[model samples]
Target chain A: MHNAHNAKSILHKISRAFLILIAFTATFTAMILSPMLSVNVNAYTEKKVYDYGDLLTDREESRIEEQLRKASENCGHDIIVYTVKSLGGNSVSEYSQRAADGINTDSDGSGILYLVSINDREYDIYAFGEMYERIMSDRELNRLADDLRSYLSEGDYYGAFSEFGKRVEKAALNNEDYSGNISVRLTLSFSTLIVSAFIALIIVFCMKQGMKTTRPEITAGNYVKNGSFKVTVSRDVYLYTSVSRVRIQSNNNGHRSGGGHHSGGRSSGGHHSGGHRSGGHSRGRF
Target chain B: MTTSFKCACCGADLRYSPGSGSLKCEYCGTEFEAEAVEAMAEAAESDAAGENINWQHANPQTMENDGSTCTYSCSSCGAQITGDRTLAASFCPYCGNTVVMSDRLEGMLRPDYIIPFKVEKDAAVAKFKEFCKGKPLLPSGFLSSGRIDSVEGLYVPYWLFDAGVKGRVRFRAERVHTRREGDYNVTRTQHFMLYREGVMDFEHVPVDGTSKLGAEVTEAVEPFDMHGAAPFAKAYLSGFLADRYDVPQETCRPRADERIRQSITSALANTCRGYTGVRPQQQFISVANGKIAYALLPMWLMTVNYNGKSYTFAMNGQTGKFVGELPISWAKFWGFFAGITAALTVILTLLMNYFG
Candidate 1:
């Protein structure tokens, strides 16, 4: 009877050890698989390319998406490219705004979106947040659109999107914007210091010259007798006439209002009912 | 020969008093009218002539001139004073007594008119201080280091010219008209050939007559009011240094003509108005009825030494107009420049950030 009882106790201890091994294996497998699952989710969510129009192949879309992702990382702003088959009942501007509003990534909403509508043959660029206030203006958006219009007209959609990515990246890196409305990073560069020093030297030189009060008198104005000047024969004869004409320059460049439809009803941080986002856009037929 | 004026009361040396028109004794404080002093000297000369006494023997200070230089004995201290032929009056360095070289002022060298000093030495020193007051860049030690004893009264000779100028001036002038026509700016310029002829007279244009003084230095203190001028007398030379005309009259004629030409040309140019631009094409000026006279003008001169350099200052004795070049302090200049530059840089940066 004692031998039988010891055999039962050993058997119970073996089963408990087997169950613990099973639980450890299951928890370790879950820990490894969960990260892969989250990575897949983040990869989809972080995608900057939304090609619903079937303009690019899967491979081309992936390549452009990777390019835009790197560029966004570099410029600290999300850059997006969205293509749609139809705008439904909305204008290109509203469609683009909806596309921007649908972005659910974890980035701060300081970004720009390039939208293309295949059926409507229209394209638009929308900016929000810091990117809007710093570098995006109506003129700059139009300039970017004009630069990519040729590729779009040629039906090289892949090339157009790729060039768009490159140009946006370059512009973001340079922080270039429309003239007369852009903030400049103030720096006391060597050239600025040199020019300032030169100007200062000239001012001080003039001040030093003022110390010299003596100069040779070349005119005798003080010695001229008053009331003694006379002009006996004064004649003004017409000799010839010459005429010149110059065309006046038009000063209307870069002051044009955007041709795109604008809605002051989207917040920079999130979509709202009627609050206007501080941003700008440009739209045109491709 | 040097002649030192003596006080009639105490026999002490008499010096010419500014704005008083008289000689005042340094010891007795007695003043004698300049005209009365001249009358007494003339009466003495006549009495010596009546007695048939040699004037040089009676006045032992008189001596013969040796070519371009003259030596005279000071009546007050008996020190021998030597100077160039142009030196009409000077002070004896050892005795600090004034001596007038009477022989140098004889004959053709005599000045026709003299403007007596109206600004005294003390007033001139005050004017110097005033002149240096407003200058910010002047060296800090310049005014403090300047000595008052270096200031001296001087009678500078000048050649006064009166001339009637007849001139003809031709100018190429233009009248420009600008009009806007349909996105174009149309400019029409009317060219004209202008001729102006004039006759004018200039009175009493004084030119510096001493070669020792530069034209710039002498011309700076100008227009000694001829109204204050009196007939030149030897009494005016007492206690003051005088310079005879070292620059010849012929040598100064070109300067007078140049000045007259400039005046006439400017006068003719003034008549041409209502033109956008006028440039002189040709000018022909002829000076007529030119008259020249010699005069002695008063100037207060001082030399200040600073930083091992001497700077000369001069004041118009009649008008008290002082002129001099002041030294610049580099420390102050650089500090001001840096401050202005920093201020402007900050302002420009703020403006760019706000507007750009």
Candidate 2:
């Protein structure tokens, strides 16, 4: 009976140790699996500039894709240029938000997508990921749009796309000198001068009016008997407050780390923010 | 201390001294208070009345007639001076001017009221410089102290009109309220109509009674103190050039009526306050029982010719309000514009560089 009891005890101890080893192995495997999964985070979408609407010729499209590929590799962030015949009845915001959710980045990082809708006559620029504010500020995006204004208006699609790629590359690099846009700088400088001159001219006109001291008295205020001024009629009526609301516009050019810095700042859980992460703003024709 | 303004000690011309507020001899500097002069004047009038004297209003023949009124001619300045025969001006009071007035007094009707010059010549000279002080383009030494001090005092003829005015006006007003809710802002306004009615009494509104002195130049010197007015006395014209009405009261009536209408309308508008927009929708001001009188108000006139164009400066005798035109310097104007533009450009460029 003693020999049988020792065998039972030894078997029980071996089973408990076996369960403990299994739990330890599973925890260790998960730690390694998490990092390995991060490696595939950006593998879902390698096509940086998708011409799904076939807006460009095959050769032009290939050339743009090559440039975007270089830009993406150099900037360490995805750069996308998309064109669509229709927005599938979605507003630009809604459509771009959906597209951003569907496309995941290589490193699960920040990215910018410029889209053109041929039928809707509308274009939108969206910045996605945790570093949306860092990727490009609203003012920078507006400036980028302005640079494309002439090309878009003239229907020079290839020129506009090429310029867009160059500007995005420059912005991603955070170039400090020349800003790659002398025309915009020159226009802003010249307008400032014109507006300042107009304001100065108005000041001079007011000064001239001051020199002209003689003015016809318009009110009887001076002549009214001191204690005699009476309103005689006072009535106020209530009117309904009609409300109108518009989406908030951002003009803050806040400090951003562009694209790569936010990876460490973000959570490792990596389920995507609310399943619709976006801090992008846009201006459109339609 | 005769009926006329004459030197009691040296037989020199005695004029009212503004600094001492007395009549002083120009030659001997003998001072006599205005009260003493008033007393002597009354005594002289009583003496004349006791003799049962009667004076006629007519042009004196040859100006040598020893009558109540006579004329003096300045061969140097060509000025025609008309005053009491006993008060023969020692020097042309309107003299020292290169430009002379030589017209003869055909039949001068005496003025009913005269405002003695309250501000002295020295004070007027200082005020004139104050007017030119801020004009950047004014030529240096153009209006020297000596030149401005020589400005001659003149009894300017004016038609004083008195009237009772009634004005009625209508105004549209608004009250505004603003409210904010969520991302929306709303402004609401209430409209109202207001009526104002008032009656005001305007004692003395003056119209220039001289053709030689244009209306614009004469009206520039305004608001003479009628309170200090003494009866028009020929003795008061000792050191000043006095004129009679060249333009009739009938001709100056319309101007007085227009001023009265404007004054009442403005006066009524003041009573309708606390409105968002108190605009005069309609105004009807009428002058009633208007009385017009001929009077002489004191003024100082100075004309300086520069670059073939003459600029006239008029100063109110009582208030010393100076009015004149400022000559613009093209060089200064263009320089100011360029300087401002360049400075603003530099600042803007620096700001853009720092901000960009």
Candidate 3:
């Protein structure tokens, strides 16, 4: 009966909440659609770059898919590709430098790939993919791939590539040490230290409280002749004259009546018990 | 405080009968041998023998009853009847004790301690009478017969154990804060600790030691005074039939432990509240059995016959603490049941219309 009642109440509450939600949504829709709610429009521009590659060439599509898939998997990102026809051997360097200029980069000879990016690290892989493998030797490219794979697996893709770049620069700089970035490592280590300290402090405090209190014992005895709730034997008997009365006469007659033991001792301790001040139990505000 | 040379065979108001060198029952015309009587007198000194005496394997003895003993029976009765030596027997207030058989005396463990009956036979009868008067639902003829079954005095055996209990409790407490608009994330983490070294003292934890009786029967008569218990003697069991310990000490210890642990858990909980980041972290308790003593207490038990059912009543001999059930009137029971159902329906309907 109780379970049924609870279930009914639960259903009622859910339906009531749903009704309230619908009512709220209706009011919000009316307010949002009102003429007084002005739409904010900002100036924007769009340019479409059309592709006219061979539509039925399987080999060409497969090759492009392979490149995009490799970039996506290695960098933990999603990469989309659209086929383009040849433009009289327009070199990647020419287009990259032009894009870099549009973004106001100071380096004239440096190439900067412009790609719509969902994540910074993944976008870095796209630019690295177009250049590093093609420009560098097989041994160096394999080494960089291994490093990037490990970094992405550990959720530190950007950090790993940044360190790789710094290492290459250092090697070129005649073995000079250059600390490119250390913020992420320092932040992680410091947070771990703080968490450990808090746990240790709580444990110590509980132990102290437990050791401090030593109140005199209070024992709540058990019910002896329980269940006499309805029936029990009620009659007095004596062993000699009657069969019911039982008498307990003290005995010093037995040889093995093991004598009782009695001892008393006092110890020193400041034990606070019963109801202590809740005042001491506050987490200080920083 | 009192002296008496009463007949051991038949309890009769005795006066010194001439020509008889020993005690004699005047009504039954039975004589006790002088030497045997003297030995019986020495039995008082033998009480010390009862201090640690074991009655586990003692032979069962049958108690004698006369034609006065009548057993009543009823179809709806659930009570068992034992006969008393009396010419007048009332309807088995529970089931008219219909079975007329020889009364039996079973001996098992001798009680080590006992609380003597402070309420006399007359007082007990008066209490029962008074009890019946208030039970208006009972049939009017039930108590009018005025037949008082021999209110044979009895010493019921009990075991008392003392111990110390220690426990460790583990709990989790969480405090939540929200910065509603920007970041509505709930930061909840479990904090663990070793809640060690809490101790409790347990006393008079009772474990029923009679194998013949069920635990339900024992629990029905709870809360005997353990502090006032005196050492046991066979003399206290006179005139009443008693059962010895068919159930052993070790066997009953677990029941006591279970009760004590349940009690301690609650006691520990009372202190567990009122902490900000405090919840039960861990919990464990150990109970060590301490001094164990046997006790026998006084009780006035009666079975009653009502409508078609039998109800029982127990009056504590020492403190007059009464516990037991009285048969409920069918009319009143159905009336209350219907009334409650109707009330619940009305309340639920109103709540559903207004709030649901």
Candidate 4:
């Protein structure tokens, strides 16, 4: 009986040891292999939606994420929509940049980020890498922000995100670089130059006229005798009336629709960890 | 015959002091009333005529000529002088003495009235400098004393006219009104035919009587105070040069008539107020009881030379009005043009980028 009890205790001890060892080995294996698997997942499928603020439902987030992925595929650039509960002592710009660094995993490091910070009540639009080069000017970025401002203001996050994806896809597909429209730029430049030339001509002409002081006298009003003018006959006869109408012109272009306190700044291109992010960002309360 | 005024206190030659109504001697500083001097000269002339002396022939210093140009001997220096027949008074080039060619001022060549110089030479020079002060394009050397070739006071001849002008003027006038309805603009206009007739009198309308002076420059210094004019007196011409009417009265009548026609048209147009696009259609005018009087008005004439070109300036001696054309610097003009164009272009470009 004594031998049997001792053996049973030994068996219990080895079993406990073996269980602890199994737990530790499993944890160690997970620690080592989880990162490798995660890297594989990140390489293959990048998450385009991060909804920490709970502003969007699971279905809506999924829908938007899929839409963004499709748009990214269409445009050959990564696109993301990230929402946060708070900025955690960092500016919306800094937080968005860090998030973009983690999210955009493409080899080319080309992506666009639409970030929302609920606690700060602010939003940011940042474009980097190849996207930055494609959207060349701040004016085009402002135009994009203007399009989304109304939707965001109305608390329509899904619509705003959806519309943003659609617009990015459409803009990329059209491939009409706003800054690269050389004809329009040249026309505007020539017009400004002509107006400036006209103004200069008028100034010089007036100065030239100032140099000429001689003028021929064409009236005898000075020599007219006072109280000597008389009127013998006066007559007036009316003839006819004419009327004309013209239509006033209206601008129908859908631009500059929403009102917001938008502020913009130059982003350091190729200076951040996201890899050659040479673009601008506009931030404002929606 | 030539006449020269002499001071009574000393036998020195005298000159009419501007704004003083008197002749002053530069040597003795003696002042004599212009009227009293004229009276004394007339008495001497009558006495000499009563003695059967032909002053034109007896005066050995006098020379007569019937051609376009006349030669006279200066009383001060006995220098022979030749000039245009219309040169009534001039300074002798040899001695700088004021000489009046008496033959030029006799009969129809004499002026009926004279407006003496109220502004002196120093005052006129100061005015010209002030006039040159604010002009930016004037050449830097144009105001220098060396560039001022001459400044001379001359009594320019003018013909003054008095007439009654009778005229009728017709005009096509329109009243326009515009209003906006919805998105369209409607403009309505009412047209009418208007007629006006009037008889007006004009007095002392002057026309330049010398072809030597441009009508444009002379008329620019016009509206001389006719009330200040005095009866023609040779004494007034002692210090300044003078000219007789080389342009006859008949030749100047058309100018006076044209001026009257413009005045009548303006007067009629002024009556048709509260209307736009008032255009004169037809006009008929007649001048009746037209009378002409010759007068000598005072002016200070200056000539400036810059870059081998001469520019003339004139000042109304009675009113101190000055006028002249200035030179332009093309370098400064183009520089200003470039600077303004660059600045405006940059500004417009920035605006378009922000708002386009």
Candidate 5:
């Protein structure tokens, strides 16, 4: 009976060890196959570049596709170029954010989207997730927009997209050298003028007030009519209400804003100055 | 002619002490009510009214050999005093005594109201000293060279005008409201037409008319408590000198009118309330009728010649409000400008570098 009990205990220990081995093998196998499954799904589904506006010719599309794919792979970021014939009654911002959500289905929202609305003549650079904050400074972005959009305006679509890819990649990688650029100089000069003017006014006012002994009362608030303030004629006529709109040119294409009522389309390209400043200093170190 | 107020309790001399709002004996520190002193005196109150302005022509003076042109003696110290046409006994420069040289002043034009000195000479000196303290650019010698010793109290002549006015004012005002609709921020500004018509009664708007006193000094010393003015008494002039009006009432009337017109227009414009901005488009003020009275307001005036430049400073003998022009140092101004500008710019640059 003692021999039989010891044998039974040993068999039970062997079975437990074999079960542990099987569980480990199954986890390892799933880990190995999961990435392959996602890659295959993404290969068939995810779009790297989009030419919805149909502005690019087939050869131009292929070239842009090649540049964007390299930039995206090199930076570990989903860099994309999307164009649409119209915003489809949606703001460029809404469309771009949606496009970013669609294109980055398999990844975290860490990428930049260059979206163009052809008929609106507007283009926006929208950065998502952590990479959004790491993008170039607004001043630097202004410089970029001001510099590269000339090619876009002249209809050199390939040249413009190509230049945009290189510069955006250069900034995202924190390798830009703006120390010799005129943007930095313009910033310092303009800041000095504005700050100097304000300080000069304060000093001038203090000196003037110091020298001046008397300022006659501006208003006879002392002798205001009885009962403080009384308005017997309280009529605010509904004089026809007119609405005026200003078409903002967010792309820096030298398009002057015209006064007219607009449809529901608003450009989502707000100022990127606050984030761009950090991007610029990152630029400085490199 | 010189007049003096003596303290009833101490039998010592009394001068109008500004801070106490009474005639105060400097030696015994006893205060006496100004109106009480005026009433106890023998001369009866003559109901001095605004219509009591009497104009006179002046006689030309000859320069004296001793540099004492017009002879006016200090009644208390027996010192010889001389000044221009408005010359009254200032303190005896030698004895440091307050003496009112009261001759030919009352006969020319008796002031209907006197806002006696509510601020003392020491207070005026203190105010002047305070004004000189912060001005590092001022020539050091200007303060140490007894420049402030020239400050003295005098009753400046002003004509008080009372009037009932009819004011009609028109204003253009705007009210703006903004709303966000889809992509557009719609701003609607409503323009308004406002009119105000009313009657306002203004009392005791004093306009200085003394030829010896500049408008610069007098206006700076303004806003005396006209309500505190006791009826003018010669007894109040006992230890203090008063300036007789050198400019006629008619000449001063235009200034008073201008002041009242501005005041009424502002008052009426303010009555059109509840607008983002209200601007006076048109104003019409008509004085239904006005009354004018000659009065004396207190002021301490000093004009110092420092570095061959005259710098004028005045203190309100009623309110201790000090006003003066100080010498400017361009070097100091630029030094501060450079330092502050550089400091602020550095801070701004660092902030922009971090989060521009």
Candidate 6:
């Protein structure tokens, strides 16, 4: 009576073990690959410097200009010139110590600029237009411009930005930093990473909370019907609902099996916003 | 003379299907009328029905304390039967067998249906063995086959109540408004009715009939296959011991009713959407058709004595689903606790450095 070959149970155990193993391996792979990916990104960036792209709104651009004027007036840099370029694709926000002049219209004696700010940071800038384009790649030009503005902010405008421009001029003289001048592409890549990370985290958190299960209630008749679960953006901000049924019937004979079935549906609705707009809604029922 | 009935077409045994309302043959697909079988089986029931006497007077055995120090009393014999929190009562302790005593069952609300045991005793044992095999904290000697005493067939008391439940709730929802001052938008609420029909089915829910065990203890031994339960039969009690519930039948009705009400009301709140806050103003649930029964089911019971503690295990006799107490190996427990703490601490420290 002790013979033990139960195919169903054996299969169930094996499947569960396989699932757990897969889960652990996937988690481990993600952790190990993250740092490697970051390193690869940093290396690629060092070889080919880029721009911040055209993700910033017109309002953001103006905000950066306003901040720069306040910094120049209050910080006593005596800002001789202020030129904030839309850059179309290569927007800079932060600055360091370097080029104080010979940027964005030196002919008019109004080229020594200070800052170009955005949603994330402020960048130092210098622009030498068509006259310098033959010598500088767009990528190098953006970097030089940012560094020049940064140099002025740190009060070392002559050393950093001046040295950067000198290096560009040398590269032009020798002809080397021109082939990899993808300033526009680099800006797009950086912007894409930031936006994607934000969106992914929001979606993950929503799905996790939405499907969370609660403890079931046990009844007097030995029946354990599942309890209610809520899907919400926040507590009481219900997005969807679902219900399940547990049925028990009388056993006419001592040789029958008694079990229940599960079936249900859910619906969810929420707001999706793009640009500077809000109040558009989408609802899904399934 | 013994008379046997088989399908005329395939010579297969026929079974009655409720949904079909007829006796269908497993082989070659034949159907038979229950009315015809009823007349033929009448003689068989007369003899077997002898055991279906008054439940109160049946299985009257005397109070004999089991040798085990921690026994709960047997419902039939009034015999002292020892059990711990983890031990599901299956058999009378003194009898050393799996038999359901008359006292531990409902008087008439017993299950009329059950799913027969598909997994045998050995398979159930194997399942338990696999569960314990690689658990680092489990002791090697704990699962030696010699320690397993026996399995019991018992009919536990349960309540099956049905009712329609409804509730009204009021809530607040918020929306935002923007003004062109410096920049950003301001938010506000637009309240609305989040009403829904949240209906769910109620089944063989277990409300413990006896107060001998706490509610928590019973809950821990979850997930019985009521689907495999058989009709009430003292013959099923032949190989096992059973207990009569000490608590009165009426005493357990209110508790079962309470669980139904809670599930229904909570379901209502769950359906509503886009509300800031919702409070249950009015709620109602009525237990319609209050019926009860007594039946004998199956369980495999085991007890182990370790370091001055008695641990128990119960396996569903019909389905081979197992539940039991774990003998905590203090050394392994400490090791697991320390390892988890250290790993989590390291991860937290790394996160702090990266984000800080």
lDDT of 2 by residue, A31-143 (tens): 43343334212333577667777778999988888888787766656677888889888787666655665665334556777788878878877766532545576667777
User: What lDDT score is found at residue A50 in candidate 2?
Assistant: 72
Q: Which stretches of candidate 4 lie over 4 Å from their true place?
A: A1-192, A240-286, B1-108, B177-188, B305-309, B343-356
By DockQ: ranked, best first = 4, 1, 5, 6, 2, 3
lDDT of 2 by residue, B172-285 (tens): 556666666555555655544455656676665678777656565667566566667777766676666666565676776766656665666566666656657666555555
Better candidate number, 3 or 6, judged by DockQ: 6
lDDT of 3: 0.41
Q: Sorted on lDDT, highest at the top, how do the candidates line up?
A: 4, 1, 2, 5, 3, 6
Which candidate model has the greater DockQ, 1 or 2? 1
What number of clashing residue pairs does each candidate have, in the order they appear?
0, 4, 82, 0, 16, 87
Give DockQ: model 6: 0.04
- Give the range of the ten consecutive residues with the poorest summed lDDT in model 1 chain B: B51-60
In order, candidate lDDTs are 0.67, 0.58, 0.41, 0.68, 0.58, 0.39
Error of 1 at A103 (Å): 15
- lDDT, residue B153, candidate 2: 72
The runs of at least 3 residues in candidate 3 whose Cα sits more than 4 Å from the true structure, single-residue gaps closed, are: A1-286, B1-108, B121-153, B169-194, B211-217, B275-284, B289-291, B305-309, B336-356
Cα displacement (Å) at residue B66, model 6: 23
TM-score of each: 0.54, 0.48, 0.35, 0.53, 0.48, 0.37
Give the top-scoring candidate (TM-score).
1
Which whole-number lDDT from 0 to 100 does residue B110 have in model 6?
A: 26
Candidate 6, lDDT over the whole model = 0.39
lDDT tens string, model 1, B1-356?
22344454465765443345556567866555655455334333333433111111000123233355554444764544344545554544223345555443232245777898888889988877777776766765567653645566777878887777787776778899999999999999877667787988777778887765667667877756777889876666555665566677778877877777777778788888999788875666666566777888898876554554556678888998777767776656765566555544545544543565
Q: Which stretches of candidate 5 lie above 4 Å from their native place?
A: A1-208, A218-286, B1-108, B139-141, B176-190, B211-216, B307-309, B343-356
Model 3 per-residue lDDT tens digits across residues A1-286: 8557545655664565455545644553343234223311111112111113333245544544454444333332223322223323433323322332333222211111222112222222112221222222234434544555555556542344344444333332231111121344334334433553455445434433332111212223353233211111111112122212223455768688553121111111333222121110000100
